[model samples]
Target: MVSDRSKGEVSNVEPTVCWVVALKSEAKPIISYFELDHQSGNNIFPIYRNDKLGHSLIISGVGQINAAAATTYLASESGAPPWAAWINLGIAGSMDGEIGKLYQGVKVINPTKEKVFFPGYRFSKIVSLAEIQTLDYPTPVKKNGVLHDMEASGFIDFATRFSCNELVFSFKVVSDNSEQDMKLIDKMVVNSLIGNRLQQLDALLDKIITLSKREKQRLQIPDEVEEVFKQFHFSVTMKNQLIQRLRKWKIQFPNRSISDLVKEAKTAADVIRNIDDALTDLKFDWT
Candidate 1:
């Protein structure tokens, strides 16, 4: 994939990873209020540069809808190579912890009040996980999830459509407690607290991205080709048959070559297409 920064120039062979921020006001602390790039580019991902912290990232505007939209747009508009994963990074209110600490989200509860599990992948030896609930409105209330944020739901829903579960991650830096007024937490204060942690976050991102890229490469083999068959618009019966056949082959030969899988799948597609064509011809009857 080409980096938008260089127009069509293929910059990095490495899969691009998006670090999405929320609304302009929410993003001010990480990147400047005006510098958020909704546009596509290589250097386009929003980030804040502090002398202490190497770089911090941000997404779009706020709310679940805005968060989802921004995340969807980012996933679609690739300035960097198609990202391996979409990372939702921002500040959050924590009920159980002290301010300024960072935590990885392990579970996401929807605004409908249903608890949805969307957890981040484990990176290296570091254990970064938290259960979070997405609320319609900002709440100072603390719950079992540990932290409260505005954008992970949008990021998770959008990214999952394009990539696997391993490709989505949410890192929330605690800005204030549920009891504290969100209005009072300013950029300087955020910088003061999270500035040092950006490096850690970046390192973690690098690790996760590496793993995601590797996994994507591996799935490009037979499994993904089979997935395409199952997901593609085909007759339900044909899809089920194909899935069953593929499952049997996979079960028998745990490690099958992608070439064999592709051949088999292509043959199935050819048969299906031929059958459809024959049906159409039969439908023509005698003119």
Candidate 2:
């Protein structure tokens, strides 16, 4: 079922999609995941083929450095044949927006230091693009302005190397404000909304794919090198946890390939596995 709207040169590009979530449990909140064959199919939002759309999601936990590091590693490792775009999708706090409304971030500004960052997306209105801003702590009061979050800025720098202007997109759903009772909205509620957010996400992907087609020629797919960190080995438990985190990063930056990330996992694992050795190594460095 090809969508009549799926008009574009079937360039040999499989857009790798990444979803970024704040919490580990919040990743891929959607219950039943479906793959569309073409944009013309029965499902809503001009369905497109799953194969043509390479997708991955990430849960970088909380904070800016973690988000940036995860993103940098993910981008460096995306082993997709022709990596397409990188997307950061998750919940955010908006000052002037209502709950459940999705905003294509036009400006990513840090309220703490007044640092401004822009998304790679092309927007008509003067809006902030999605950016990761370092907040001192969870915003307790709803100040004024657009969305607020922990990690969009970190992913932007690494993602830029892969695709051009249209290759990056930031989609955020308003979850809490300074006025809302955030305690009531626990893990269960956030998880439930993730399921609902997928629908809107599909719509966003549709629009993004169309844009990618228009600027396909000017796009420059990044050729990333894999540097396996052999410093340490990880135990089974630690390995699983790291993989879980890696999976979230992949989801956030779908364009990232498993091949690129496995090395980091190995390195991280080695460090965890040889804790004493790692400590000794650190001691040696200090000594």
Candidate 3:
């Protein structure tokens, strides 16, 4: 159960999107695009935010561990709501993609840890999709059809824990490819790669923001449900069940009060049973 107090702690800023980038160069275009202000006093990781737009960002220096740690740090400092979207955006080496083409990482694999993570909804119309493999060190693209990066696997692995898989995304712009050499790429090159794709990035973000809002509504706990949580001693499992049932009940019978129906219930099980029984009774009546 999300108690009001806990909710208050995380709901203050109500950021709708959190971006995790591996380098300052990668973050530059996005920060400018979103008009996010640098949060002062945090040197461990450079954080930025625009409360009104519900956007927050963190620039992790480099590598998978840095990406993961920076993600966790941003989540903690930003206090982003659980429904907020998480995006890992940066440059990557591709086996065959165009030098500046952007692609969403449909599948992310961490070769070092032998972990695989599928992140984000398929926005087929907005951008191209590709497979991303995160490695410990920068290496030339040795395989075909895969985008090689150093941060996505770490970002996805940690970001999904803060939100859901559908809300966590990894987008990479091909900075170096077969024709382009990775060794020659510089900060200016990184900036240009990401900067050129801002328009497409905007389109993707608009869609994600829409989905995030819908998710926020679905996960919202009613005031009455909060009261029930305060009154009952629901275990973690029971709490989740109760919240799910309440959401369904609200949809089926929006005019009814779930709290009133469960007022006489003495325990957590009773609360769940009463709601289930009410839903069952309604179904039976309709038949």
Name the best candidate (by lDDT). 3
Give the alpha carbon lDDT tens digit for every residue of 1-287 in model 2.
23333323243435456444456445635312533333343221122234443544445667666666665554444443223667766667766666766667666666665766576565434333433443646665555666777766655655666665456766666777666755656777676656666655665666666666556533332232112223345466765554445444444556756455444444665433333332233322222
**Candidate whose TM-score is highest:** 3
Give the least accurate 10-residue stretch of model 2, judged by summed lDDT: 221-230
My TM-score estimates for the predictions, one after another, are 0.60, 0.58, 0.82
Model 3 stretches astray by more than 4 angstroms: 1-12, 227-245, 256-287
Model 3, TM vs. native: 0.82
What local lDDT score does residue 112 receive in model 3, on the 0 to 100 scale?
79
Candidate 1 local accuracy as lDDT? 0.58
- Model 2 residue 271 CA deviation (Å) reads 51
RMSD of 3: 6.1
lDDT of 1 by residue, 9-101 (tens): 222433355567774444553454213233335343343322121222445667777777766665454432333666777778877666766
Please say which candidate is ahead in lDDT: 2 or 3. Answer: 3
lDDT tens digits, residue span 1-287, model 3:
22233223332367889999998999999888777899999999999987767789999989999999999999999887889999999998987888899999999999879999989999989899999999999988457899999999988999999999999999999988888899989999899889999888887877898799889887777678888998889999998899888888887887977767677989989999988987785653453
